[model samples]
Target: MRPTRAGTIQDAVARCYRAAGGVEAVAEQLGLANSTVSYGTEINEARPGGIGVNHLARLAMTDPDCALPLAEFFAALAGGVYQPVGGVAEVISLFSGCGLMAKECGEAQAATILAATTQRPKDIAEAEREIEEAIAALTKSRAVLTSLQSGAA
Candidate 1:
């Protein structure tokens, strides 16, 4: 059967959580602001019983991929037609790479590269040069990551 939005969101979140070692890591991988992911987790934790559609709707607005059908589900609950939110797959795909790298390269190495890419250096030219060097280094790391992915490590 084809995957649904809700299923996809759930899967993506779960995979990210597992790969990143936690929701914070997942949030970082997703490029989401830490406060946002923390708030969402807090809400979910507070409502251990369950949160209503309305609450979920609010969450979807803040973090669209938080749940499935996401926009539609929220809309339907808000007395509107179900309108799907597109591009969630792309978001998931992008974040999934971090998880893949984490799994393949080990968290320490993955974190090193992630930090390097996300940081803003004092000198733009220097940063660019550093990034180029990092990319070149990836030629070696990629071989290792690839082997790890293939279970050859």
Candidate 2:
């Protein structure tokens, strides 16, 4: 009942902020001003200049949950559902489980696209890694769900 960021991009930003351990940490990590980080994370609509697309990407890369809400919103807009991975690792993806799965999937997709467009070996290799990670995440998520369904979790 609580995939909190799934509802809005602003919520996702705030989630990312929390995932990063708050404004000061993210600000220090991203070399962004504290005020900018604060503004980006605030859920209030009155604030302007919420994180830019590039900054969002940079920030999202720092943590997994940061990207889940944004990904889910986009998936919904595209008439698809975003499936999250299980939260198993320290310093892992979205909401821990599902967010991680979606983030991995999205990163893999992006890598594949870059490989296709550039046809570079480095890009291809990165794509392969991304794909493998995504598959693992999805597999884990599936297993968890199966266990839950069978009342084994």
Candidate 3:
């Protein structure tokens, strides 16, 4: 899904709020004032106010499930891709698989190039396997990203 930068951070914060069972609950869990936890953010706004780094940290520490989504939303606001921390093993696995598949795809492409240059028979089978692996990796990556975006994983 193409996630809009608008309100993404606020939206993530809202998800955290819900996950923690609302602003007061979050405040209690994080040991912060209700106003502080709810400050500078509009859960329903298309674009809401930004949360400070300290507050974000507190939320993440209090609710690990919300960490990745929050960071990703903040990254979108910053005009960059969010890199997941090592907090979630599953996300790390997905990212690692993507990297390996990317490497394999590159190797297959290089083989195809070499065959073309040397007038050798192209390894169609190998090429197909590489394509499949790449597709699978992409699919997995997309799933992980969607999960992270939705704050469900």
Q: Lowest lDDT 10-mer window, candidate 1? A: 83-92
Number of the top-ranking candidate, with lDDT as the measure: 2
What lDDT is reached at residue 53 by model 3?
69
Off by over 4 Å in 3: 1-8, 43-51, 83-153
What is the total number of backbone clashes in candidate 2? 9
lDDT (CA) for every model shown?
0.45, 0.73, 0.65
lDDT tens digits by residue: candidate 3, 1-153: 112345556667767677667778877877778876776354435435445667767877977776867777777778975643333444466658678668877876876666556664456555656666555556566766777789967
| Per-residue lDDT of candidate 2, residues 1-153 (tens digit) | 113344576666667777777778878988989888777745556753376778878877867777776677668879976766454343243247688788999999999999999999999999999998988777676766666689766
lDDT of 1 by residue, 1-153 (tens): 112234333333343234345556645655666555444333244443132345444544555455444444346557875433233232233345455444544534544565677764544445455544444343345555555689764
Which candidate order results from sorting by lDDT in descending order? 2, 3, 1
Candidate 2: worst 10 consecutive residues by lDDT?
86-95
- Which sections of candidate 1 miss by over 4 Å? 1-22, 30-36, 44-69, 81-153
CA-only RMSD, every prediction? 17.8, 15.9, 11.5
